[model samples]
Target: MKARFEELDFQQTPMGELMLRRRTEVGTGTDIYEVKLGEEFLMSSLFTVAEEQMATLGLAAAAGDELDVLVGGLGLGYTAVTALGDPRVRSLEVIDALGVVIGWHQRKLLPVSPALVEDPRTRLRRDDFFAVVRQAPAADAPRYDVILLDVDHSPRHTLAPSHADLYTAPGLTALAEHLNDGGVFTLWSDDAPDEDFHATLASVFADTQAHVVDFDNHLTGGTSSNTVYVGIRQ
Candidate 1:
């Protein structure tokens, strides 16, 4: 018999209704967690290989012993936790637009929440990632060695309409200002590799590459792919 799912937490944000749920897999008897925004599925514990890879790949491309990282989304805390795993990462600032998502980590509701909260090197900041990137850096602002973003569904598809501009060349240029010299910028997309988005990145950054991350989709019983775009600042 298929195990039943339980709603762990739910909240209403400016974006939409947010919910966190968990269920046990019937065959494996392992808990599967999911986050949803309204009727749209945001993330699932069943497939986190791409999310974890976003951090590992981004950090590897960034050259530095003492690295300061910036993560644009805190979904399930997988990327944030993965970044903290690196001994070279001196600090990680995770920025999320939704406060409820941050609360999920602070309350230790998500599976990766415990590790994220207990890590002193990680700091969760509630702010609009696009706005933060678009604004001029303050005198005390700290430029990151690498900036990993996984907020939008894709460059063409976004959770919010306002996020579409962030994928553009001009918007990407603004975000590049937040990175140090030779810094890396990585973005995770639910869709497959998009050449148009790659062109946009290439126009703004010195070097750009798109990586296809494939993982098993339990729901479909087949392999599914996501794209990770990596750009390096000069």
Candidate 2:
């Protein structure tokens, strides 16, 4: 039998210690890929339903043939790859604060790295998504049709405490300015549906919806759930 566990890479970033690992399940023999920051688990291949849904549901809300998408956080490249799967997506700019995570994809360390690099539509940008949104747009700044964020654990819970502002009214207003008219903003949350966050989005966007995605949890042997919050620019 193949080795059950392997550590692919480890590095220290401004946020914390980031590690990429791959493990094979004993019973099911499923090869699972995971990324962790410090002691917290950032992402796992075992649960990506909500990630893909963030792309599909957000893009579906955008009205246009050629769409430009901005995906915050490049964890495992699941969300970015899912966004690229759509033919309507003309360009996909994935922004991640951690350069180590971006290097994993550039070095083809992860399984999806090869595909992510080969896709001409996708561009990996090493920058803080929240800071970029807060900044004033350049004269020729490219407005996106949809912005999908998965960096924070949730609106209330964040990897960095500073990220909490991004979900507030003022922060949402700043992000909305970077979107094209009627563009969509979507985010993945580890927590269940949050009415307060939903209200915050509603206050900024014309329409908002929260989707509860359920998937089987191999660790707990039961179902797990996540939330995908989507907001449309006016």
Q: What is the C-alpha lDDT of each candidate?
A: 0.93, 0.91
Candidate 2: Cα lDDT at 130: 89
Per-residue lDDT over 1-234 for candidate 2, one digit per residue giving the tens place of the 0 to 100 score: 678999999998888788999999888988999888888787888889989988889999999999999999998998899888899999999999988889999999877888898999989999989899998789799999999999888998888877888899999999999999999999999999999889989999999999999988867999999999999999
Cα lDDT for residue 129, candidate 2? 92
Model 2 steric clash pairs: none
Q: Estimate each model's TM-score.
A: 0.97, 0.97
C-alpha root-mean-square deviation, candidate 2: 1.1
Model 1 scores a C-alpha lDDT of 0.93
Q: How well does candidate 1 match the true structure in TM-score terms?
A: 0.97
Deviation in Å, model 1, residue 135 alpha carbon = 0.7
